[model samples]
Target: MPLPGTKSRDAALIAEFRMISGASEKIASSFIKKYKSTEAALDAWYNDPASANGGTSTPNKGQEKKLGEIWEKYKDSSDPKLVKIDGTLAICEELGVDPGSDSVLFCLAADLDSKVTGEWEKEPFVKGLASYPGNIDSLTSLKNYLPALRKKLNTDPTYFKKVYMHTFTLAKGQDFGARTLQLDTALDLWTLFIPPALTSSPSALQRTSDQTPPQFAEEEFDLWIEFMRKKGKAVSKDTWSLLIDFIRSIDKDFKEYDDEGSWPSTIDDFVDFVRTRRSSK
Candidate 1:
């Protein structure tokens, strides 16, 4: 028989443990009672596998069911298998995220392993959620996890690069035949991806201070945007992807830039633009 009040207070504990560890009800109950918390129980299960008995660290039936329910709830009504922009917006609303904020939206997309900007397929949705650490069986849990996900994006450079590269594809939309991103769109995306401090908006600065250090100063990003407005027609895939590399490799004053290096002509032109502005000042 289940322990007293297990149906009330301890239910979430058992469910989370079972979801992460793939333990049976009896096993989950035993571990919870022994360890006293979901994190502790999971720690014991992973650090000392014998304590888990036969429970495997994999998604179990319960997780699948819960994920399925969430999918059905958020999936596009017309397509049933896709979470379209409307569905995506609903999710953003639930999570208290601004759909207009590409920085946070892109991070969320990375977490969901989204393949498109406005659409999410069932497979990636299920696999991403199933593989995500911590409990995300409900929207509430997923919302609670967003801070950690954002922190990872801010702190983990490699992971941030993955999301950054992925954003190029997402921003391009479903036009597979297109080879370049629109200049206006690229400018908007750069503002979001580069760092919130670039905008000099009070809210963005606050967010930037709370997160990672800025990769480039506000003046640098502003100059780049100004140069783009003057000379850029469209942003090729190479330019779009290499901009991050440029920011990381070059200093704010362009002291480290090598004209002989393999930077794209667009970046080369921007450097020239910067030099001309500096010499005239």
Candidate 2:
């Protein structure tokens, strides 16, 4: 307490910790002292179930009010209660994310329960922020929450699948009645959603002993794209949704692929296409 400059330094650290973890000053100070840094304190706070129950589980009334304020700050100029593309870009900037980043945008959309790509209504926007693990009232808290969200996309297949499927809905833009995704748009999305590897096989793609099972072999993905381009047809909803099942069910060599199965016609045709190409090679 007697240290002159150390008081300000401690206060700054405590403030940063409070912002990130929504901890009170006393709690923040205790964590900071125990962990010796703001980052470490946050790590401890996130891992501690007792602390998390109080601060991180769900936003309290004050945090909900703060979320409303943040929403108003970024609301669309035209709509006042909506967040459009311009507002979304501004929010992305505040969160330290590139507005052009597809993966981050996908994660954000899933987290915020965004119904479409360029627009967010007030109900879902504030509600989703409130549902987030920790209090995210300010840019600092939002920025701090993003890494964990992105990591969930990378590490949890089930969570990634949920987000990936929602991406199709988002990609439809404002068209609720749309049943097909355009060929170019579908291909671009496949490239973004399907994790890529440099090699053609799963074994070769493994960089570590504990790597998760490969989702799409690069060669197989290329063949699918080639077949789609050659067909020159819009991707039907069935085809798009069934592609995930197809990828998970088939062997890399297509030995397990069954044309007689209940797969969409496009998938059946793509299997034939793969076989024809393989025979020619």
Candidate 3:
């Protein structure tokens, strides 16, 4: 029989949520009581590592390899949604909680990190929801590197990339008519599903991916002199600055490994960086 009292990892969650939210003991206990069912299942899963996919506490070397393993195991899962959401929940559960707010927040971070390349490579952005184009859904969903995108970018670059490209194609300088495309409806159809996610009532920003590091790396961030020539398609000046800022943000993480530099995580961040920087100039 499983251990009594509580599962191993999820036991830690009570503390995590408390720390992040600064919940009072009374509030925390009350919240725990309110969400007892979710907490219990989460803890139980943590107690049994198998409840989380892989059934092992160790991580496979790289994100790419890890993703390959997940695909092999679950591509044929009897329950699809279970594998997708619950699988992710396993991580949050391990982390102490899985708030929908957190999921939506991270997705946004990923887009900003990867420069928002493409949410899906088809119309309507949402993978499976959108008509697949070029036989590829999104970089985030690509077969080989799913885990890598999640690990490295803290977001799914492939999936977001695919949807981003599709959104761009659809919105390429094309203005929407009054009340043409409902904001939430648009995000619902996209790979990332932003509006309903970011705001309780949706924002008007629509779809926009523009980060910078990837471009600099793509262009080798070759001294400021060459930044202009290569940056047109790869990045913009404001994006370049933001990349510089972000690099500073994680200087500690990348410093020990290599003094070179870490890149931004999304296409959206990059695009804005360039535009903002240029406009400022």
Candidate 4:
């Protein structure tokens, strides 16, 4: 009744779904049957973004299952504080997110769309977190699932801005600055978030060599100095992150400024705005 290799293919899909959802084989099979193909089914799950429907809704059943699994594991724990705090750390560790102090709490609140009930105080924020059950672990799973959405969206330049904007928002303006993000974590964000955002546009392709210069010349440090001189500012490794965020914003506003059919198509554009033929206004 099934096509050649259909059994193996179906088994593979079941395994992948189980890994992502922690669902039983029956649940995974039921989940996978809704799509014409495994890939299409995965796409539907990932493309659904966060919302306010609480447990009844999410981008996909897999995400809902992840939250359910985490809750089922820890919901009845005797130590609420331990589950609340250490459980967050466990989720962050799995997601490769920073968990210094209670940073995970803030991240969870932001990701879960919890209301900002207090004036930037953790106490009030934590108290208001009641709206989001599964709290820390739920947010972690949501963020963990976002990259799949991001990867799918990256194919369309329009969604590139969405990826970083969503990331920065979830970070709550605290994802940068001195000792804020480790080098490896920063690199991961850059790899996942930067390259897609910086992709040059079709309009930029026709530009001449003189119009677009490299961001780095013989010496990388010298190029950095040139960049500072143009902006009349200096940056340490920590501060450089702020600049990166600024660039992300610029990309969001302009939607591929590189596509403007002009210069400044490369990182070198930031080196000297004046020489890059960009309007200094």
Candidate 5:
């Protein structure tokens, strides 16, 4: 089960993710209900972080029957889209907001993942992973079901993955400004959250040129003044978002990364180290 104080927060996070990503609350609530119920079987997911396969390839009709009943009732509801609860677990693992944290955002992450998958955008989270707060090993893998409900996504995402590799890159940001990412990245100035799959390894944003990507580099106090002189927007939301993500990247994962015993005990530490390197360099 999620930690004691986390249930309501889960609701809120899912709600926020829903609003931002265009999901509905009713559907989020159902997911939480299922996640919390048979948690023991699934909770280990957090500690292990490697079992995020979306659907059981082999027959598991016993569990499927139980999950299908819920899917059948709510799947058709117009209030919100819902996948079979089991189908969602793998995606939830990748998204990382324990089904029980601030619901407002989980809903959004859920919807966002679904929409990204439905539209056949590069589904980064499909095989990504994250550490849950209380999980023993602090990691979980994520994947998608083979056949998705949305007809648009009937085609495999293998193509979308190629598009991501083909399109987004060092030059695009320079030519387009940060706005090129408006649709592709889930940037929120408010919560300082980014999809863990995409957000990890802040250093990964380094420019193809010797110079660092302007966004990942901390804006020195001097640059702030210069931008002010140039009448640049002092608080462009993206800048604010980058700033918040910087802080959160440190705050959430710093301990695991910077410790001199410093060897990464697990995957989280390795990812955290990537974030710290981005902030410092």
Candidate 6:
């Protein structure tokens, strides 16, 4: 009693659900039955208009006005010698926000956009607060606004890792190491991950609610195996065990590799040196 193309459409929908959810065929089939199509399912779950505060698209004008009022009070003074970054940081501090936080960075950037060039500057910064998405006009409203935005954005749990790496390139500080603690604190608020270790205090451990063991990407493990084989070492569980130890050690003393922003760091270089001096049996 099936329609001519019903089987194909159902098959395609099931496949799409599997790809999107990484769920098994049985689970994806259940989802497909309930939603009918991938697009509908995604939209219903992610962009639920009912949950989006009555589907208001633009920033709330009343909140924007409140933010604008605050901006006028804290807009940069006409002192040529005062660094703009310093002024921005001071204003964020007054608002009880971490100046280096991604939320602050995004909100401040939006708040400071210039009308002429759409660049973050003093005048437009005040004007931009009247907008939605990243409005930081008022700390009081932010308590409610941020949660709503987070739901809208569907922010991934691992988003902070990207933020963490991006900061190194974006930040314009010579001694960034000194402010590493601030970065850790700020990133911890936005993402859920137990850092392998904290360089600031080697003994300090950050455990997540799940308390599950750290998960390594398949490619990371592959690279470890490749590196060992290239050095003419026998690939074994012991070798992987050593590499895991190395990874933990690297995380514990990240400051040592903080100078280089590359993944796995100079840990390989150190490993290579040790390998060279080893006596071949």
Best by lDDT: 2
Give me the overall lDDT of model 2: 0.72
TM-score of each: 0.72, 0.73, 0.21, 0.40, 0.24, 0.36
Residue 231 accuracy (lDDT) in model 4: 53
Q: Would you list the clashing residue pairs of candidate 4?
A: 215-268
Error of 6 at 162 (Å): 4.5
Q: Which stretches of candidate 4 lie over 4 Å from their true place?
A: 48-110, 114-163, 169-192, 195-281
Cα lDDT tens digits for candidate 6, 1-281? 98899989999988875554343476556556778887555344333422223235455677567766655555446754222555556555655566433343543342343222112343354444444333335665443344433222222223323332333323323443342323333234323222322211111121233322323333333444445445553222233223334443343223333334433433455444434444342
Cα lDDT of all candidates, in order? 0.71, 0.72, 0.33, 0.41, 0.32, 0.41
Error of 1 at 75 (Å): 1.9
Question: On a 0 to 100 scale, what is the lDDT of residue 15 in model 5?
Answer: 60
Q: 170-251, model 1: which lDDT tens digit per residue?
A: 8888897788889999988887766643332221222222433444577878889999998759899899877767765666
- The residue-level lDDT of candidate 1 at 88 comes to 84
- Separate clash counts for every candidate: 0, 0, 57, 1, 29, 3
Q: Lowest lDDT 10-mer window, candidate 5?
A: 145-154
TM-score computed on alpha carbons, candidate 2: 0.73
Between prediction 1 and prediction 5, the one with superior TM-score is 1
Candidate 2 residue-wise lDDT, 212-231, digit = tens: 36544778888898899999
Best by TM-score: 2
User: Which of the predicted structures, 1 or 5, would earn the higher lDDT when compared with the native?
Assistant: 1
